[model samples]
Target: MSKLFTSYDLSGVMLSNRVVMAPMTRTRTPSNTANELTALYYAQRASAGLLITEGLPISEEGRGYLYTPGLYTDEHTHAWKEVTDAVHAKGGKIFAQLWHVGRMSHVSIQPGNQSPVSSGEVPATNTTVYAWTEDGKEGPVLPSVPRALRTDEVQRVTQDFVSSARRAIEAGFDGVELMAANAFVFDQFLSSSLNTRDDQYGGSIANRQRFMLETIDALAEAIGGERVGVRISPFGRLYDLQAFDGEEETWASVASALNERTLAYVHLNYQPTITAAEVPAGFGAAFRKAYRGTLIGAGGFTRELAEAELEKGDLDLFAFGTSYISNPDLVERMKNGWPLAEPDRSTFYGVIGAKGYTDYPVFDAGNESLKTVA
Candidate 1:
């Protein structure tokens, strides 16, 4: 059985344990840039085996919500450096998540308030991205129909991922993970249901995986493959986009390609962002067969269930989400089986700083100040 505290070697960086803080979206950044409060939040959660920063927009167009921080400009890099330095000072390993929302964004958050990008001209269905208007009310709105990215422009967008990776590296992140999942830009190109374009980037399953494959190569080029990992919600659903059964054959092809490059690890987020129905039967088992490198599984997993799953040899690591939301000392809680504090749903989406973002209590520390959950 794989214990949570035992050290593991991932991408040549020796980790003290296997507990990784999954990439979550938090609006705690200062004025759309990382600041001291954000640094304190993350530095407080530095005990996690590994840390991944919240989803940071690679470009202004990637803003899926209001007040969400980004990694585009020099100021962004400088701001994030404080976070990385703080995390490292606490003896933690951290990775930044590179994000691009594509059609999953509202026009109000974009530069000049223009339409977002998507693989096709159609708009996202059955989904809504939240944003705060001038009056500061959180409202969910449908994204405008995105202009299909031209062949030449596609490289520029991919460059955004590359540039973000470089910025993350420069910001003192030990590594970086590409947000290739969750119906984002990479997700748009990977799903057969979301991408209907007939260009070289679409059509067959191999073609569907092309953009992700190319993005991985581009990111690896920016940062070494050993320091790069990609997150995929292969069976997750949002915006009426879902990949199942043979539709995930692209994952197999892409995983194989990614494995050949010897990237750090591949993260699979297996839960539906909204409904419980997104857990495809036998999906994790199939992914274990396809991926040759380290695999991290994320979803609603309990310690007992995670132990059983790990015993099956399907996942090398388990990413606990909601459980860690208000439990900054999650690893310690796991070690002692402590009861977890409930996360407040009211403040989860685009609120402000230190409310739900940093109010989590660490059990072992005996009511230590509200801390960040990696």
Candidate 2:
């Protein structure tokens, strides 16, 4: 039997298979609240062993895009209840990915049109954020320079994460994954190039990691440590975030730190476009050795490659991003060797309706009329 189809235990949750649906941002929540459509979208892909929701802002200040969902309000928690109920009805386990955009945000999305907050006062160049104009049209716009977070305010942000995690539990999520990757708030603190603060939150490797580790501590205290997972992009340079000389040492410290926690998993996101050497050689194995917990790898992974990695024990689970977006029955397709459908890149983001959202056709060799689960 292919290892991908084998059941595995993540923390205490027993998944039916090893295929995880990686989180992808679909900007359908205009009101920053998950609704029936969001529920249907997730329930359609319940076959995945584990399904992670798109990055959800922990607070109004954490919002980076115009239409992403938030978890800081009672209304948001009530709305997400519908989504979690739908996925649970289909026997699926889901996790909420908590996010804080930091300096990657524009004032248009910030509360009261204020400047975005970050570890430092630097601006991310050649990067843009989704913004809505007066005419209600939405598109990418350049982000504004951000003010450095006050040393005392850092703890407040960590409390926001704790509150968000509690809300996620109330909304019926099986777990919560911190968005510490892709040059977001947590990543900003981890990057030596971005975090130039002199306090306990920056400067040395241990100081840079203090915020992340402290956030994890708070999250584990609110929710059990076993129910928390973290995602990190160690070598990512996206959003004008440059690679520094201490990248290896920084990540090693992170891995070693996480090893001490009874966490669920450490998710690694590999950006193929950033460099030809995707994931650098032996990176996965080295991390697995360091963390000693479940490790999930996400990128452009094929079925053959996923199987090989699982067979060799490099990855405990394989996360599919674009493939899951287009094919809701991705696990079945992989099992039956069905041809996969290509996702419509044009409709990948900022779509309002089901045109590019839930309209993807399920595989039908007989070429029958396509139908959505909902």
Instruction: Report clashes for each candidate as comma-separated counts.
Output: 0, 0
Which ten residues in a row are the worst by lDDT in model 2? 270-279
lDDT of 1 by residue, 100-162 (tens): 888888777778978888887768777788765557666777777787788777878889889
Q: Candidates' lDDT values, in order?
A: 0.79, 0.88
lDDT tens string, model 2, 125-227?
8888898655667778888899999989999999999999999999999999999988899889988888989999999999999998999999999999889
Best prediction by lDDT: 2
**Cα-based lDDT at residue 210, candidate 1:** 79
TM-score of 1: 0.92
- Model 1 stretches astray by more than 4 angstroms: 132-138, 243-246, 271-280, 364-374
TM-scores for every candidate against the unseen true structure: 0.92, 0.96
